[model samples]
Target: MTMKKLGFAGVMIVALVGLSLATQAQVKKGKTRPLTTKQMMAGLVKPQCAGLGEALKAAPSDDKAWEELATKAALLNESGYSLMDDGRCPDGVWASACKNLQTASAAVLAKIEAKDYAGAQAEFKGVTASCGECHKAHKK
Candidate 1:
Protein backbone atom coordinates (compact mmCIF):
# COMPACT_ATOMS: atom_id res chain seq x y z
CA MET A 1 0.00 0.00 0.00
CA THR A 2 1.06 3.63 -0.49
CA MET A 3 2.43 5.39 2.62
CA LYS A 4 -0.55 7.77 2.62
CA LYS A 5 -2.99 4.87 2.44
CA LEU A 6 -1.22 3.00 5.25
CA GLY A 7 -1.25 6.08 7.51
CA PHE A 8 -4.94 6.61 6.91
CA ALA A 9 -5.71 2.98 7.67
CA GLY A 10 -3.73 3.17 10.90
CA VAL A 11 -5.62 6.26 12.05
CA MET A 12 -8.94 4.65 11.24
CA ILE A 13 -8.01 1.51 13.23
CA VAL A 14 -7.01 3.61 16.25
CA ALA A 15 -10.28 5.55 16.10
CA LEU A 16 -12.32 2.39 15.87
CA VAL A 17 -10.59 0.85 18.88
CA GLY A 18 -11.10 4.00 20.90
CA LEU A 19 -14.75 4.10 20.00
CA SER A 20 -15.21 0.45 20.91
CA LEU A 21 -13.62 0.99 24.34
CA ALA A 22 -15.79 4.01 25.01
CA THR A 23 -18.95 2.15 24.17
CA GLN A 24 -18.05 -0.84 26.36
CA ALA A 25 -17.34 1.45 29.28
CA GLN A 26 -20.76 3.03 28.94
CA VAL A 27 -22.48 -0.33 28.75
CA LYS A 28 -20.56 -1.68 31.76
CA LYS A 29 -21.43 1.37 33.81
CA GLY A 30 -25.09 0.98 32.95
CA LYS A 31 -25.00 -2.54 34.35
CA THR A 32 -23.45 -1.59 37.72
CA ARG A 33 -25.56 1.60 38.02
CA PRO A 34 -25.22 4.46 40.47
CA LEU A 35 -27.79 4.91 43.19
CA THR A 36 -29.47 8.17 44.09
CA THR A 37 -27.83 10.18 46.87
CA LYS A 38 -30.36 9.12 49.51
CA GLN A 39 -30.14 5.49 48.50
CA MET A 40 -26.35 5.62 48.60
CA MET A 41 -26.23 7.14 52.08
CA ALA A 42 -28.95 5.02 53.67
CA GLY A 43 -28.40 1.70 51.98
CA LEU A 44 -24.70 1.69 51.08
CA VAL A 45 -22.46 4.31 52.66
CA LYS A 46 -23.88 4.76 56.16
CA PRO A 47 -24.28 1.08 56.83
CA GLN A 48 -20.96 0.15 55.28
CA CYS A 49 -19.10 2.82 57.21
CA ALA A 50 -20.68 1.80 60.48
CA GLY A 51 -20.09 -1.83 59.79
CA LEU A 52 -16.44 -1.14 58.96
CA GLY A 53 -16.05 0.65 62.28
CA GLU A 54 -17.49 -2.31 64.13
CA ALA A 55 -15.31 -4.72 62.24
CA LEU A 56 -12.23 -2.70 63.07
CA LYS A 57 -13.08 -2.79 66.74
CA ALA A 58 -13.70 -6.50 66.69
CA ALA A 59 -10.67 -7.37 64.51
CA PRO A 60 -11.47 -11.00 64.60
CA SER A 61 -9.08 -13.36 62.80
CA ASP A 62 -11.89 -15.55 61.57
CA ASP A 63 -12.51 -15.68 57.85
CA LYS A 64 -16.06 -14.41 58.19
CA ALA A 65 -14.98 -11.21 59.94
CA TRP A 66 -12.35 -10.55 57.30
CA GLU A 67 -14.91 -11.18 54.61
CA GLU A 68 -17.17 -8.60 56.19
CA LEU A 69 -14.34 -6.10 56.15
CA ALA A 70 -13.71 -6.77 52.47
CA THR A 71 -17.41 -6.40 51.75
CA LYS A 72 -17.52 -3.07 53.52
CA ALA A 73 -14.53 -1.86 51.54
CA ALA A 74 -16.15 -2.92 48.28
CA LEU A 75 -19.39 -1.18 49.28
CA LEU A 76 -17.45 1.96 50.07
CA ASN A 77 -16.09 1.85 46.54
CA GLU A 78 -19.59 1.38 45.20
CA SER A 79 -20.87 4.27 47.33
CA GLY A 80 -18.47 6.61 45.55
CA TYR A 81 -20.17 5.57 42.32
CA SER A 82 -23.29 7.33 43.59
CA LEU A 83 -21.38 10.57 43.83
CA MET A 84 -19.90 10.17 40.35
CA ASP A 85 -23.03 9.80 38.29
CA ASP A 86 -23.55 12.20 35.40
CA GLY A 87 -25.11 15.48 36.62
CA ARG A 88 -24.35 14.62 40.25
CA CYS A 89 -21.04 16.41 40.44
CA PRO A 90 -22.06 20.03 40.33
CA ASP A 91 -18.52 21.28 40.83
CA GLY A 92 -14.86 20.30 40.75
CA VAL A 93 -14.61 19.94 44.52
CA TRP A 94 -17.27 17.28 44.69
CA ALA A 95 -15.79 15.44 41.75
CA SER A 96 -12.30 15.44 43.27
CA ALA A 97 -13.50 14.31 46.67
CA CYS A 98 -15.50 11.49 45.18
CA LYS A 99 -12.44 10.35 43.27
CA ASN A 100 -10.46 10.35 46.48
CA LEU A 101 -13.12 8.26 48.17
CA GLN A 102 -12.93 5.67 45.41
CA THR A 103 -9.15 5.51 45.63
CA ALA A 104 -9.23 5.12 49.41
CA SER A 105 -11.85 2.45 49.17
CA ALA A 106 -9.69 0.41 46.83
CA ALA A 107 -6.68 0.85 49.12
CA VAL A 108 -8.71 -0.29 52.09
CA LEU A 109 -9.86 -3.37 50.22
CA ALA A 110 -6.31 -4.29 49.29
CA LYS A 111 -5.08 -3.76 52.83
CA ILE A 112 -7.80 -5.90 54.34
CA GLU A 113 -7.25 -8.61 51.78
CA ALA A 114 -3.61 -8.74 52.86
CA LYS A 115 -4.61 -8.63 56.56
CA ASP A 116 -2.73 -5.38 56.93
CA TYR A 117 -4.78 -3.67 59.59
CA ALA A 118 -2.37 -0.78 60.05
CA GLY A 119 -2.43 0.03 56.36
CA ALA A 120 -6.19 -0.29 56.25
CA GLN A 121 -6.48 2.08 59.24
CA ALA A 122 -4.38 4.65 57.38
CA GLU A 123 -6.38 4.31 54.18
CA PHE A 124 -9.64 4.57 56.11
CA LYS A 125 -8.44 7.94 57.29
CA GLY A 126 -8.19 8.94 53.63
CA VAL A 127 -11.80 7.90 53.20
CA THR A 128 -12.84 10.02 56.18
CA ALA A 129 -10.79 12.92 54.91
CA SER A 130 -12.58 12.81 51.58
CA CYS A 131 -15.93 12.70 53.38
CA GLY A 132 -15.06 15.63 55.60
CA GLU A 133 -13.68 17.64 52.71
CA CYS A 134 -16.91 17.20 50.75
CA HIS A 135 -19.15 17.95 53.69
CA LYS A 136 -17.20 21.03 54.64
CA ALA A 137 -17.30 22.44 51.17
CA HIS A 138 -20.78 21.41 50.04
CA LYS A 139 -23.00 20.15 52.82
CA LYS A 140 -25.27 22.54 54.71
Candidate 2:
Protein backbone atom coordinates (compact mmCIF):
# COMPACT_ATOMS: atom_id res chain seq x y z
CA MET A 1 0.00 0.00 0.00
CA THR A 2 1.03 3.57 -0.63
CA MET A 3 1.95 5.87 2.24
CA LYS A 4 -0.99 8.14 1.44
CA LYS A 5 -3.33 5.21 1.78
CA LEU A 6 -1.76 4.26 5.11
CA GLY A 7 -2.56 7.73 6.37
CA PHE A 8 -1.93 8.87 9.93
CA ALA A 9 -1.17 5.46 11.32
CA GLY A 10 1.51 4.91 8.75
CA VAL A 11 3.06 8.23 9.46
CA MET A 12 3.03 7.49 13.17
CA ILE A 13 4.68 4.16 12.60
CA VAL A 14 7.42 5.83 10.59
CA ALA A 15 7.99 8.33 13.37
CA LEU A 16 8.19 5.63 15.99
CA VAL A 17 10.69 3.73 13.94
CA GLY A 18 12.78 6.83 13.50
CA LEU A 19 12.61 7.48 17.21
CA SER A 20 13.72 3.97 17.93
CA LEU A 21 16.68 4.28 15.60
CA ALA A 22 17.63 7.60 17.09
CA THR A 23 17.50 6.16 20.56
CA GLN A 24 19.73 3.35 19.51
CA ALA A 25 22.20 5.75 17.92
CA GLN A 26 22.24 7.82 21.06
CA VAL A 27 22.96 4.72 23.10
CA LYS A 28 25.86 3.95 20.81
CA LYS A 29 27.18 7.44 21.42
CA GLY A 30 27.11 6.76 25.17
CA LYS A 31 24.64 9.51 25.85
CA THR A 32 22.64 9.56 29.03
CA ARG A 33 18.93 10.07 28.91
CA PRO A 34 17.32 13.13 30.36
CA LEU A 35 13.88 13.06 28.79
CA THR A 36 12.36 10.94 26.08
CA THR A 37 11.25 12.56 22.83
CA LYS A 38 7.65 11.68 23.63
CA GLN A 39 7.96 13.33 27.01
CA MET A 40 9.40 16.46 25.45
CA MET A 41 6.64 16.56 22.88
CA ALA A 42 3.94 16.13 25.48
CA GLY A 43 5.38 18.38 28.15
CA LEU A 44 6.95 21.12 26.08
CA VAL A 45 5.88 21.15 22.46
CA LYS A 46 2.21 20.46 23.10
CA PRO A 47 1.65 23.21 25.65
CA GLN A 48 3.70 25.78 23.78
CA CYS A 49 1.90 25.00 20.55
CA ALA A 50 -1.42 25.31 22.33
CA GLY A 51 -0.47 28.66 23.80
CA LEU A 52 0.83 29.95 20.50
CA GLY A 53 -2.26 28.76 18.67
CA GLU A 54 -4.57 30.54 21.10
CA ALA A 55 -2.48 33.68 21.07
CA LEU A 56 -2.33 33.72 17.28
CA LYS A 57 -6.09 33.75 17.00
CA ALA A 58 -6.01 37.51 17.48
CA ALA A 59 -3.37 40.10 16.91
CA PRO A 60 -1.79 41.08 20.16
CA SER A 61 -3.41 44.39 21.07
CA ASP A 62 -0.99 45.27 23.84
CA ASP A 63 2.52 44.73 25.10
CA LYS A 64 1.42 41.96 27.42
CA ALA A 65 -0.27 40.00 24.68
CA TRP A 66 2.71 40.40 22.41
CA GLU A 67 4.99 39.24 25.18
CA GLU A 68 2.87 36.14 25.70
CA LEU A 69 2.94 35.27 22.03
CA ALA A 70 6.64 35.90 21.86
CA THR A 71 7.22 33.62 24.78
CA LYS A 72 5.21 30.86 23.16
CA ALA A 73 6.97 31.26 19.82
CA ALA A 74 10.34 31.19 21.52
CA LEU A 75 9.41 28.08 23.42
CA LEU A 76 8.19 26.46 20.24
CA ASN A 77 11.49 27.30 18.61
CA GLU A 78 13.32 25.72 21.50
CA SER A 79 11.23 22.60 21.14
CA GLY A 80 12.35 22.32 17.53
CA TYR A 81 15.96 22.55 18.59
CA SER A 82 15.40 20.01 21.31
CA LEU A 83 13.91 17.61 18.83
CA MET A 84 17.12 17.66 16.82
CA ASP A 85 19.51 17.40 19.73
CA ASP A 86 21.35 14.44 21.23
CA GLY A 87 21.15 12.26 18.13
CA ARG A 88 17.37 12.40 18.28
CA CYS A 89 17.07 13.20 14.61
CA PRO A 90 17.23 9.83 12.91
CA ASP A 91 16.67 10.72 9.29
CA GLY A 92 16.50 13.46 6.70
CA VAL A 93 12.76 13.85 6.83
CA TRP A 94 12.82 14.27 10.59
CA ALA A 95 15.66 16.75 10.31
CA SER A 96 13.84 18.74 7.65
CA ALA A 97 10.66 18.91 9.68
CA CYS A 98 12.47 19.99 12.81
CA LYS A 99 14.37 22.64 10.89
CA ASN A 100 11.14 23.94 9.41
CA LEU A 101 9.66 24.14 12.88
CA GLN A 102 12.56 26.21 14.11
CA THR A 103 12.57 28.46 11.10
CA ALA A 104 8.85 29.10 11.19
CA SER A 105 8.74 29.75 14.94
CA ALA A 106 11.66 32.12 14.67
CA ALA A 107 9.86 34.00 11.91
CA VAL A 108 6.80 34.24 14.11
CA LEU A 109 8.89 35.59 16.95
CA ALA A 110 10.46 38.17 14.67
CA LYS A 111 7.05 39.35 13.56
CA ILE A 112 5.99 39.68 17.16
CA GLU A 113 9.11 41.66 17.95
CA ALA A 114 8.43 44.00 15.07
CA LYS A 115 4.79 44.39 16.10
CA ASP A 116 3.73 43.35 12.63
CA TYR A 117 0.42 41.69 13.28
CA ALA A 118 -0.31 40.78 9.70
CA GLY A 119 3.16 39.42 9.13
CA ALA A 120 2.95 37.51 12.35
CA GLN A 121 -0.29 35.92 11.25
CA ALA A 122 1.24 34.87 7.96
CA GLU A 123 4.31 33.48 9.62
CA PHE A 124 2.20 31.69 12.21
CA LYS A 125 0.69 29.68 9.38
CA GLY A 126 4.20 28.45 8.57
CA VAL A 127 4.65 27.46 12.20
CA THR A 128 1.46 25.41 12.20
CA ALA A 129 2.29 23.92 8.84
CA SER A 130 5.62 22.75 10.16
CA CYS A 131 3.90 21.12 13.07
CA GLY A 132 1.41 19.46 10.77
CA GLU A 133 4.15 18.15 8.54
CA CYS A 134 6.00 16.69 11.45
CA HIS A 135 2.83 15.17 12.85
CA LYS A 136 2.02 13.75 9.46
CA ALA A 137 5.29 11.86 9.61
CA HIS A 138 5.42 11.12 13.29
CA LYS A 139 2.38 11.65 15.49
CA LYS A 140 0.01 8.85 16.33
TM-score per model over all chains:
0.71, 0.75
Q: Which candidate number maximizes lDDT?
A: 2
Roughly what TM-score does model 1 have, to 2 decimal places? 0.71
Backbone clash tally for model 2? Answer: 0
Candidate 2, residues 1-140, lDDT tens digits: the string is 88899899998999999978766664233245678766787888889888888877887889998998899999999988878777766567778888999999999999999999889888888878887886786665
Local distance difference test, each candidate: 0.77, 0.81
**Stretches of model 1 off by over 4 angstroms after superposition:** 1-35
The stretch of ten residues in a row with the least summed lDDT in candidate 1 is 23-32
* Model 2 regions more than 4 Å off: 1-31
